[model samples]
Target: MKKTFLKIGLLFAIVGLLAGCKDPSSEAPQSEGPSVSTTGESISEPEVVLTDEEHNIAVNYIARSVPLVIERTGSTIPTNVFRADAEPPLPIPELKYGNDLILITYGELKYEDEINGVYLYPEYTVTYSYLEGENYASFEFAVDDKGDDYAIPDYPRYDAEYDSGGNPIHTVPPAKAARLYATIHIGERSTRFNIDMILHPQEIIYEFTLDEARAQPMGKIVKVYGYFNGYFADWNNGVICDGDVALGLFKINDYREYMQIGKLYEVIGQYTVYHGLPQLQWIKRVTEVAAADHPTIAAPEAIVVNANDFAEQLDIGNELSGPLKHKVGTTVILNFPLRYKKMLDRDGNPVEPGSLELGKHADVVLTGKDGNNFEFEVKLSLNYHMGIDDQAAFRDFFVANPTADIYFTGPLGAYDAITLAPFAFEGSLSLTPPVV
Candidate 1:
């Protein structure tokens, strides 16, 4: 039989051992069996004795390890600068077999010291509950680099001053390598796995321009220079543009400090297509190259489009030649005689406009000129400064005026088809038509 190795939890399993190891800590509560040693050293392999529940969990884990290893064999993993309150790593799942529960704990392991590598200090006693009737066994371990306790020299910090938009300004850290290790303890038996990951700065392509980067193949990592145009708080991303072309910056949490509207920036990331929209994901770096003293300096002007032009542009596919192709990722002012068809949720289910929920996207379908239908995804949640009552009032306006000459501004993106992603409704939407 062919042996298959898989990723059980945080790290993939390369090899498994049935030997008993030193207990994690002396302070940990003792399990209901023979007392495990606490000497912090490897002991001789003991006779294996597992109850039916323990045997099932271990069997399920060993059975599923192969594909996980193959899946993550060459995957790029994001690394963060060690912070005390940083978000915890994703949790591992617990496998269930019958009525008995099998608890798994993260054991201690040695941290590799690569040059300028970010270290992973995994918690030792994270517990997971096994749900009833599930056959698979999985576990999650929280890893963080304990603040000053394991501080390295020359680590970068955010600047004390805030930008005009109240966002803190900071310098991005250089890429580093990291090798993480963790021990998985199932009942009395333990297995160890180590993950080798390059923290950031993976194969930088600083030569590519924003437009050139867009042409590169999917999943290719590239670095581009552009100006910060706008942020989509609803989607947790921002838009950046060179003088000619614009690209969406996905997942700004790591680089939020350097984000300021109209500032020039250098971004390094993997080019990806999210729901048909071109975006850069797993952003490695966002460095402000030039500051924007005024908001209008680096902001890209929105392209004005009428309903007929908008529908014609939407009909042209992203790869085909059309006016909207060049306008993707940039803002556009759309003026159309509105005819509301229906409202839908992200999953494409019909939803009454008045019943739209907060923090969820309300995808409203509207009939354009020549009966061309396009979607307007209302992202009022992105308007962070809006009150609940104001948001509701703004939402009701769309349903209330089902047929009116309306104008709105939003970044032109594609999701299954052309979409107008309006981050806020205040200044973007108007009942009266624009002067275009």
Candidate 2:
């Protein structure tokens, strides 16, 4: 007999739990069954117990949203820093918010020592929708981190103004509560719902290995680890090249600064095939795991091809090269050199001193070993900040020697699927031939 795990939620929607918070003074309400969204429809009418895997899914969704809440509440720490505490050693959040039908659980920041006289602000307030049939809801809030955990930057800590019981007395007023707002989307409909800061559920998250993730169907949301090899700021995108395979992130936020080439990261997103290449779209989170440098990736056995070979394949509309489609992301070396083309000005005339701006476009003529030639488009590096000195040297070298056997090394990209015409990324170019 074969056993299957529960599939995650829809394409971009998050998951939610079956609990809610009520007025603390009143008795707790018993839940009749699993939650029903604002649409008044339930996936299953009978009360369904969540499986272990389902529980992990639900908890992780909540965990991902917590940082947003914390940030909105005015916490100075970054979301990644806060999330790092969600694991063991740091106790999981156990506080509950709403009633049974709509439950929200979270952990509180533990204070190291009690204060005698200092005034303290409330940690934070969250406003989240209680959507039916979902494990989590999208939330919105503002952040202002003062000094000492609160967004409040300045306020000297003085001695105790405590009573005989050793309770601290406040010199300043407590922080104001945040205004709450809630809106929920269920299926094709949208409606208003209630939100409460509730108790924390048992924290759990299932980490997937790369192999396990690759086996899942396309568009499945999963968490996996990899090292960043490429990033495109123009597209607000990046790639995680991990152990012979690479995954693309369509939108990278917060972690953009940390996504230097060769840095390790753990990312969460939906896997989908985009233009014959697998990409992780709707990227929810990217966590930097390692800042240590990784070795430069060497080209795999690239079947060297000439301009004639490329043209023949294009003419026949078939891959004359070995698995060029599979080599969509891997590095392939072109054996021949390319003749440089001057940059064109606005009036369509070639510039003599030639502007070498970052992300500027240039072209070259590929000269095959057998004398075949084809124009090849080349883009300057997006990460021009890596080495200004190197860029200047290369620019000068390019200007001085236009026919210095220009070498191209980079992850191959295709704009037209049929033509399969590839371009060289700026990160993968090397004009200075390797020292013999």
Candidate 3:
């Protein structure tokens, strides 16, 4: 977590000065506008334009006081309020009268300035409005971007840790300060003020099951409670299962090394879809539950489907519903024995048996009991259990057992078709002639 400290002393001093010296009835120049009186007669309401000094005072007062009010009232400021660069930026929340709301209607990064010939800080324009009634009065401000007429504080930056790839991780940038010039209207009188304040990121974590997490809109950060199902492919990626439903976990933090298989754990990350498979990416945290507190949970059982019915099982209307849809991210076993056909690449192109390389895959075409052709990928990787030294050894086995019965057990992944990505060669793949 990153820490952002607001200068309370300066803010309170500004607030104190404005509270004592500001006049509620002091009216600046009025803009022409139609207002209905008690008698229904039209009149102009004062649209006050405050002087430089008055504008500065009002801005400072609001900037200092609004945060206190928000904290005291337990108001939730919108997360997208400070994100000027969000794609299809979320709508600023509508203001309601009773709540202490700080509505940021518009925000943008405007300029960058160098400080003491070292650090560069970016400035932003934050236009906002708040309602005033019995609780508080309404005020609107549109601060100009040009010149140094108003003081805009430097945006704060915190030290962030970087990954081996040199990408910053576990760091959330602080929102930049913007110039604020506010016109406060109370009854028939109005005044103006200006100030600058820093915006902090408010992260909201939602607890969900694996099914619920997958149903969430893409790119949503969610926390899921489930049992760690052990890593597949590498230690950084694995699956977490809640009952029969599971989600792939990728790029998890260091805590993954301590995660025990089949243990109840809370995992937090962003929900994403790679190809057609739903997975949790950029895993932020993983915490194991105490065995005494939680009843021991076993790993989810793999749903078995015969090879002849594999295609039909996955043939739902869309990816969102049906029997196999629930099994998309979960484990599955292809039970029926497969008769070997021909080896091909992912694109169905055949290569010489001697051409396959280590850590590379070739699709093995096989015939199911119903004589329907299905593709099962075979990756030639380090398989000490099978005593296979290289791709040559894999080729010799396939050549010797040209008509072997094959069975696959692994998580069902999808691309052009539903496929099995076996994590291990020993248990995940079986040959009729056996590995020997």
What value does the lDDT take at residue 305 in candidate 2? 45
What does candidate 1's lDDT look like per residue over 231-297, in tens digits? 7543477888765478888778666665777778778777877766788887767777754542433
Model 3 lDDT, full chain set: 0.49
lDDT of 2 by residue, 337-370 (tens): 5545554433334555346454443322233233
Better of 1 and 2 by TM-score: 1
Write down the lDDT that model 1 would get: 0.49
- TM-score-sorted candidate list, best first: 3, 1, 2
Q: Please write out the lDDT profile of model 3 over residues 1-436, one tens digit for every residue.
A: 1222344553344334423333334332222222223344433332444445444444334333333113114553333223223467533332222222233321111222245332211111233222222222223322333211111122233533434333556566433222233444432334444322333333557787677888887677788877777564445467778667788887654764688787888887778777666888777778788646655444577777764456564454235554575676577776676655666654558765556544455655555553355554322222222222433444555667677776766676655345555445445556742221
Distance from true location, Cα of 367 in model 2, Å: 4.6
> How does each model score on lDDT?
0.49, 0.40, 0.49
Question: For all the candidates, what are their Cα RMSDs to the real structure?
Answer: 20.0, 20.9, 18.2
Separate clash counts for every candidate = 9, 36, 10
**What is the TM-score of each predicted model, taking all chains together?**
0.48, 0.39, 0.49
Candidate 2 accuracy as lDDT: 0.40
**lDDT over C-alpha atoms for residue 23 of model 2:** 22
